[model samples]
Target: MMAMENLKQFLVLLSGAAVFGIVSIVFVLTWVLHFREGLAWDGGAAEFNWHPVLIVSGFIFLQGTAIIIYRLPWTWKCSKLVMKLIHAGLNLLAFVFAIVAMVAVFDFHNGANIPNMYSLHSWLGLTVVVLYGLQLVLGIGMYLIPVTPASWRAAFMPVHVYSGLLLFTSVIAVALMGITEKLIFALQNPKYKDSPPEAAFVNVLGLFLAVFGALILWIATRTSWKRPSDQILHTLHTNGGSEDNTKVSPAMSQLSGGMDAEEAGEVRRRNNKFDDNTN
Candidate 1:
């Protein structure tokens, strides 16, 4: 009953996050296509429009989804290796979107004879992107590489989790700053203080981004929603253990102590294979 209740709550939060993420993408698109010149690659303001659009869709939305992929109940049946690959793929795609968005901004600035990276938004935004890339590389090395030690992976799990969430939150904050900066520079006649329709619209977009980020953070931080250890699952399957009996078998527990779920899963698989070969 408790498991069912937790599943329900997880579903609710996941659905809410997905709604906010989709709405954020739609809001950004509406703002760009309706309020501003539509997208283009002519090194104009139109090209610059891609920056916010891609950032909202890929950086914030896709990246957030990737962050919480492990918490999805349906995906639990899949191997952690598969989940990691999907997670890395989503992030890689988001990174590609970010790179393209950066190019669009630089091209637009060069064409307009405007100084680049002068604003606080640009500085923080670039910093976040660079950090995100580094995080991705390190995560792949630590978690995906078979040569990596279980102890190292276990020790790095907390850092990896923390940095991912921090980067995610920072991206959203930097996005809000970028939106405000854009409004200030673009809204000369009516000014942003007057709250023109575009300003109002983009503000709502920022709100959606913030809400989406919050939902993601909430989901990621919930210990109850974490993927069950593969060792536990293996034990339950072999022993026909009840769902409530989460305690691993003695051998599995001994092998998995002090390791994170992924590392423990690796060790469990190796031990099982060794036993099978010996038999």
Candidate 2:
């Protein structure tokens, strides 16, 4: 049991490190690549690179996927199932709108000026943000309240896998779109003379993939281990089980009791007396 527990703990930590490592890498890249002095919406000249935005969008989806995956059931529960499904669906919806927005923003602004595409993209993203907020509310309510999480419920296995599927699909879709939009803009921009679209794209895409890969590794490596509370659970379960068995044993034994000859004779005499009284 100790070995099993240690192995489980090792796997869990490895998985968690992979996820955190990816997030840290991506966050650092976002800071490095997109943190140019002129990134404001105002007339200020700023550095504009769409790759970081794309990667960030995917990172959020990845985060949501991780949440949904962890919450997904190892056992059956109607309540858990519904919440997981809704969480998955909402995140996916948010992902779709967010991707559209990422592309639109890239098209609308290439760091020179805020374009119409940027406004549209911003609006679209805002709408999805609303959706994500709703999801957050629903997800929380499921934990606290006693409703079917919302009107839909399902089994835990599908809830876990489907939520992840939705998250991955939505994020990757937006990320790819954002990347394309940025690349196209770079190709068309006149101010950026030294950097090749190919090189910039490769750098952005490479970092994004690397970060995302680490997170995936973590998710795949997940293993179960008993926490410090396991001892408490073991004791409670044992005592409760023993108490129940003690109570039930005598009742069961009496129900299975057989009468000896003398007892049977006594019972017959009592029955005759009762019959005589009735007559």
Candidate 3:
């Protein structure tokens, strides 16, 4: 059991490192390497560059981080309500950045008299953005609004969880497609007939994005990594006194019970199998 716990800790650390590394690579690739002069609204091609930077920073990295916020140890020390607000707030910022990036793309396109939605990347990207917007609205309505019935929230929980993961994956995919399209479009100086240094670097960037996405999913989905019900209640009680030490909602209680049952059953089965083998 000690060894297993150690292994899980190692995996979590490795996953966090991957997330940090990938986002760092994205920053270097966008700001340090490919950045050009006058990258502002009136700067023509430079203005379009914000699209990649913001999408990567906001949609890919921040959104991915938000998805795994529950897995963070520090977050387990805080009230679940506080963590929920942080998670929602991070996602909201990501959505805002994405919207601004979209505006940058359209502004550049119009200014340059270029046609829009001409590439597969653009279509996929636009679709992801629209779905993401819908997701934010539904999520806020279901989870954040005081008027939202607990029963309705409970019913929607599974769908909410599923769609959130789906959108995170889709955002990564769309980002990859966008990166590839941009590389092909921008590096046509030599017509991109062969592998160049810039092409290789950008390809690596895409790979990092893919790796980061996979790592986040791995961290978020691990049953062993979930915050226990006792921890949630303890944290709330410690932070906000007895009056605020509310029991978890039915959905959370059910989830906790389910996880506990699974762990208990697994242990019992292992012990029974061992006794049989010994006999």
Give the TM-score ranking, best first. Answer: 1, 3, 2
Question: All predictions: root-mean-square deviation over Cα?
Answer: 5.3, 16.3, 7.7
Clashes of 1: 0
Clashes of 3: 0
Kindly report which residue stretches of model 1 are placed more than 4 angstroms away from their true locations once superposed.
241-243, 246-279
lDDT of prediction 1: 0.82
TM-scores, all models, native as reference: 0.88, 0.44, 0.77
**Sequence-dependent TM-score of model 2:** 0.44
Model 2 lDDT per residue over 1-279, tens place? 124454465456545645654654455355435533323333332323333443354445344444434322231123333444554455555455455434544554554456553543344444545555554454444433445422232222234334444544444444445444444444544323446645464456545544554555444333332121222223324445343222211111000012223334544554464446448
Predicted candidate 1 versus true structure: per-residue lDDT over 1-279, tens digit per residue: 127777789789999999999999999999999999999999999999999999999999999989988777676567767888989999999999999999999999999999999989999989999999999899889878888888787887778888888999999999999999999999987999999999999999999998999999998887666666565555555645555443322222211113455556765775575457448
In model 1, the clashing pairs are none
Error of 2 at 63 (Å): 1.5
As for lDDT, the candidate ahead, 1 or 3, is: 1
lDDT of 3 by residue, 1-279 (tens): 113554478466656656664665555346424533436677387778778778888888888878877666545556656767888888899999999989999999999899989988889888888998898888778766777766677677667778889999998898888877776777766544577776776777777777888777776675555554444444445545333233222123321111234333544554464446448
Displacement of residue 235 (Cα, Å) in model 3 is: 10
Residue 14 lDDT, candidate 3, scale 0-100: 56
